[model samples]
Target chain A: MNRLYHYPLSPFSRKVRLSLAEKRIEVELVEERFWEQDADFLRRNPAGKVPVLKMGNRLMAESSAICEYLEETHPTPSLLPSDADGRYEVRRLVAWFDDKFNSEVTNKLMGERVFRKIMGTGYPDSANVKAGSKAIKYHLDYMHWLLDQRRWLAGNELSLADFAAAAHLSCLDYVSDVDWNRSVIVKDWYAKIKSRPAFRSILADQISGFPQPSHYSDLDF
Target chain B: MNRLYHYPLSPFSRKVRLSLAEKRIEVELVEERFWEQDADFLRRNPAGKVPVLKMGNRLMAESSAICEYLEETHPTPSLLPSDADGRYEVRRLVAWFDDKFNSEVTNKLMGERVFRKIMGTGYPDSANVKAGSKAIKYHLDYMHWLLDQRRWLAGNELSLADFAAAAHLSCLDYVSDVDWNRSVIVKDWYAKIKSRPAFRSILADQISGFPQPSHYSDLDF
Candidate 1:
């Protein structure tokens, strides 16, 4: 059976999970505290990161790569667009969320607020938390603007870009970091994505100590 | 005509440049001080980073995305493997270099040693430089181990993975931060990749304040 080694709050892992569910590919989910850097986990993925997928004999690391691999092999219900330009836009936004938005917001807010406590690192850095809080508003505004222009994050088609973004935003929502009322359009966009069958597992995700917010799993939320 | 807004020492810029040259795509190179976050550059890429590619009317950001676009549009000298699994490996290694190796090595060393002075970001952090220097050895060893198995960074065939690895390493090489003598196998691998026609522009790169090291352009090095 296909297996996914992931953490409940890891946006990267969540991105892959959304893709897998959207494609209807069943995979056994195994929780891994990747930061501990266990030798066995290192053997599975030298990168020592989560969302390591084991498909029969093949073991894959890197969320974006894994997503692309799934797209290439599965091809059904494609997460990427058919055209090159469309594909570029999708990948670009994926990088934006996973790289830029992630570092500026997710890593700051969630990394400090949730990850630090869970990983036994230390208390949340107030400075980082403040910056993340400020940065998130701009991100929400940006998303609002995009949702206003297009139906989905990248375009009319719901691409991996949406999954990439929703992955990060959902993680923050788990810790009650996102302000749903900040942008009506952005909120509407999230509400639409969150209602998808693919998002069920994510809504069901229960991180220890940090219980899911009442609204996190609500379809009407 | 196609144009690329880039900076000499930016690995992300170098990666796209290499792919463009390899694909023989003629493009006007425009040096963009992206950190300054010019309003026009922001309009081009809201992410506010370097290596933005303009292909006719379509403007593109993100190095890997640009490379993939180039591969799809111009498949003559293909940068990706034909097989799904092979392509996955190439992308995995590309992420390993562009994301993992980049933050751990390239960004740390270059961000401190070269960019700090060029961007006028104050003095290099001795701690980050020290950590980057220490981390690169393990990376080189890892590369050596990989090279011991496959002919190229990802596999037997040359792909974007090679360009991605070389792009970051070349940026560090510019600052004279890479210890090329650390691993003979890795050194041999670099020598081979460094000799490619696609590498001409990278080898010729010279930052204004910091002249290219004597060995940077030397094929025999």
Candidate 2:
């Protein structure tokens, strides 16, 4: 059987999980503390990161690459648009969340508040938390602008862009870092995506030491 | 006419530039000081990053997205493999260079040595430079291992993966951060890639404050 080695709160791992679920591809999920940099894990993925998918003899590392590979191999219920222009928009938004949003909001808030404690790094840095808090509002507003313009993050059809964004936002939400009241449109978008069957496993995710936030799994929330 | 707003020392920009050139797409290059975050540049890319491409009416941001779009639109002299597994390896290595290598090596060394002075951030942090310098040896070794197995970084065929790795290495090479002497196989790979006609503009690049290294433009080197 195919297996996925992932961390509960890792947005990149979560992105791949959403893709796998949306495609209805069954895979055994194994929790991995990637930061510890175990030799076995390093052998599986030299990058020493989470969300390594083992399909048959193939082991894949990068989340975006894995997602695109999935799309190429299993084209059913396509997570990308048909046209090149549409695909470009989807990929652009995916990078925005995975790269920019990740560095600005997720890394600061989650990195300090959750991972530091979990990894035994140290106490949370309040300055990074403050900056992350301020940065998220702008991101929410930007999401509101996009959601206002289209039904989904990239376009009318729900795509990997939505998954990419929801992955990060959901992780932040797990730590109660996201403000649902910031933008109604953005909140509505999250609620819509959060209710999907694909999101069930994510909602059920439990990270030890930090109990899941009450609203994190709430569909109505 | 197509136009690209880019920065000379930006690896992301160079990746896109290499793709455009390889695909034989004619584009006017416009140097954008994205760090300044000009209202106009931010309007082009809200992520406030370099390497924004304008092709006719469509404005594109994100290097990987733009490169993929270019591959799809211009299939002649393709930059990606024809098969799914081949494509997966290429994308994986592309991410390996663009994300992992950028964070571990490029951002630390180039960000400290060149960008700090150019952006007026502060003096170079010796700690980061030391870390980057140390980290690059392992990266070069990794490249040697990969090159020993396959003719190119990803496979026998040339792909965007080569461009992505070269883009970062070239940027670091600008500041003479790369120790080309560390790995002969990796050096051979660079020499082969550097000799490509598509690399002409990059080899000709001359940063105002930092003179191009004597060996930078020399194909024989």
Candidate 3:
């Protein structure tokens, strides 16, 4: 069986899990405290990041690359659009979330509130938390602006963009960092994606130090 | 004709330029001081990053996404491999260079030594430069290890992975940061890539403040 070595709170790992579940690919989930730098895990992935998929003879790292591999290997319910332009939009948004939003928001809020505690790094820097809080409002507004024009984050159809976004937002929501009431359209967008069967595994994720909020798994939320 | 909004020093932008040149796509280069956050550049790309490709009616951001777009729309001289596994390895290495290697090496050395002065940020941080210099030897050795086994960075064929690695190395080479004497195989690999016609524009790049080192444009060094 395929195995995905991932951390529960890692948005990148969650992105891969959502893609796998969305595609109905069967994989045993193995939680990895990747920062420990275990010799075995390092052997599995030299990059030393999570969401490393062990499939048959191949060990894959890099969430985007692994996601693309899944897309190519299993083309049943395609996450990418048919046209080049549409696919570009999807990949662009994926980068936006994984790179830009990640550095500004997720690394700020989650890195401060959750990771420091879990990893035993140090105390949470309230400054970064404040910045992350402020930054998230902007991101939420951006999402609202996007959702106002299109059905999903990228376009009319659900794409990897949606999964990439939902992955981050859901993790933030797990810690109650997200203000769901910020925008009705964004909330509605979340409602649509959150209720999907692919979200079940993520919703059930239990991190040792951090407890999930009640509304996180709520379809009505 | 297409146009690319790029900063000469940005590895991401350089990566796109290489893909365009290799694929024989005609794109007018527009140098963007993206960090200034100009309203017009932001309008072109909300992310406010360089190497925004204006192709026909569409304006695109994110270099990796743009490269994939170019590859998809123009597939003749494919930078990506044919098989799914080969393609995955290519993307993985591309991400490796762009993400891990970038944060560890490129951003540290180039960001401190070059961008700080150019952007008027402050004096170069010696600690970071030291760390970057130290990290680069390991990266070159890793490259040497890979090249010893395979012809190119990713595999037997030239790939976007090569372009990605070259883009970062070239920028570092501009500041005389790359120790070519460290690895003969890696130096040979650079020699082969540096001699390509696609590298001409990159070779000719003249940043406002930083003069190009003699070795930067040299096909034989």
Candidate 4:
């Protein structure tokens, strides 16, 4: 059986899990504390990141690459469009969430509030938390702007862009960092995606120190 | 004419530039001070980042997405492999350089040594420089290990992974940050890639304050 070495709160891990569950691939989830840098884990992935999928002898790292690889191998419910332009938009948004949104929002918010405590880094920097809080409103507004134009983040159809976004947002939502009332369309979009069966594993995820918020798993939320 | 808004020292911009040049896609280079976040530039790309590609009416952002789109539309000199696994490796290495290498090395070294002066941010943080300098050796060793196995960074074929690695290394090379004496195989890999026609424009790049180092454009180096 395929085994996925991932952490509960890692957005990257959640992104891969969503793709796997969406594609109906069976994989045993093995929770890995990747930051500890276990020798065995390093052997599997020298990059030393989470969401390493052990498929047979092949070990895959990098969430975007893994998601793209999964889409290529399993084409059932395609996450990317056939057209180049459509595909570009999907990948673009995926980068937006993973790179821009992550650095600006998730890293600031989650990195301060959660990872600091979990990783035993130090006390949370209130200034970073403040910045992250401010940054998230802009991101939510950006999402609202995008959702106003299209049914999904990338297009009318659900794609990996949605998963990439939901992955980050879900992790933020786990810490109650997300303000769901920010945008109705954004909220509705979340509601639609959060209700999907693919999101069950993520919703069920429970980090030891961090308790899952009730609204996080609520379909109506 | 196709236009690319880019900053000379940005690895992300250089990656796109290399991809375009490798694929022989003509684009008029427009040096954008994206950090300034000019209203017009933001209109072009809300992300306010450099390396935005304007092809006809379509404006594209995110270097990885742009490169993938270029590969899709212009398949003549393929930067990616035809097979899924090969493509996965290429993307993985690309991310390895872009994400891991950037954070560990480039952002620390270049962010301090170059960007500080160029952007007028502040003085170089010595601790960051020390950490970046220390971190690069490990990356070079990793590269040496990979090159020992395959002809190129990803595989035998010269893929985008090589460009991604070269792009960062080239920028660091401009600042004399790369220690060529570290690994012969890695140096040889750089020599091969540096001699490419696609690398000519990058080699020719002359930043205002930071004069191009003697070895930067030296093919024999």
Docking class of 2: high
Off by over 4 Å in 1: none
Q: Each model's TM-score, in the order given?
A: 0.99, 0.99, 0.99, 0.99
Give the clashing residue pairs of candidate 2, or none: none
Put down candidate 4 lDDT per residue, A110-191, tens digits, no spaces: 9989988988999999998899899999999999999999999999899999999999999999988888888899999999
DockQ of every candidate structure: 0.90, 0.93, 0.95, 0.91
| CAPRI docking class of candidate 3 | high
lDDT of 4 by residue, B1-221 (tens): 99999999999999999999988989999999888999999999998898899999999999999999999999989999999999999999999999999999999999999888888999999999999999999999999999999999999999999999999999999999999999999999999999999999999999999999899999988
Compared with the true structure, what per-residue lDDT tens digits does model 2 show for residues B84-133? Answer: 99999999999999988998999999999988999999999999999999
lDDT of 3: 0.94
* lDDT string, candidate 3, A1-221, tens digits: 99999998899999999999999999999999998999999999988999899999899999999999999999879999999989999999999999999999999999999999888999999999999999999999999999999999999999999999999999999999999889999999999998899999998988776777788888997
Query: Candidate 1's C-alpha lDDT?
Result: 0.92
Task: Kindly list the per-residue Cα lDDT of model 2 for residues A2-69, writing each as its tens digit.
Answer: 99999999999999999999999999999999999999999999999989999999999999999999
Docking class of 4: high
Which TM-score values does chain B get in all models? 0.98, 0.99, 0.99, 0.99
Worst 10 residues of 3 chain A by lDDT: A205-214
Q: What's the lDDT for residue B173 in model 1? A: 84
Candidate 2 chain A: worst-modelled 10 consecutive residues by lDDT: A205-214
The regions of model 2 sitting more than 4 angstroms off are none
TM-score, cand. 4: 0.99
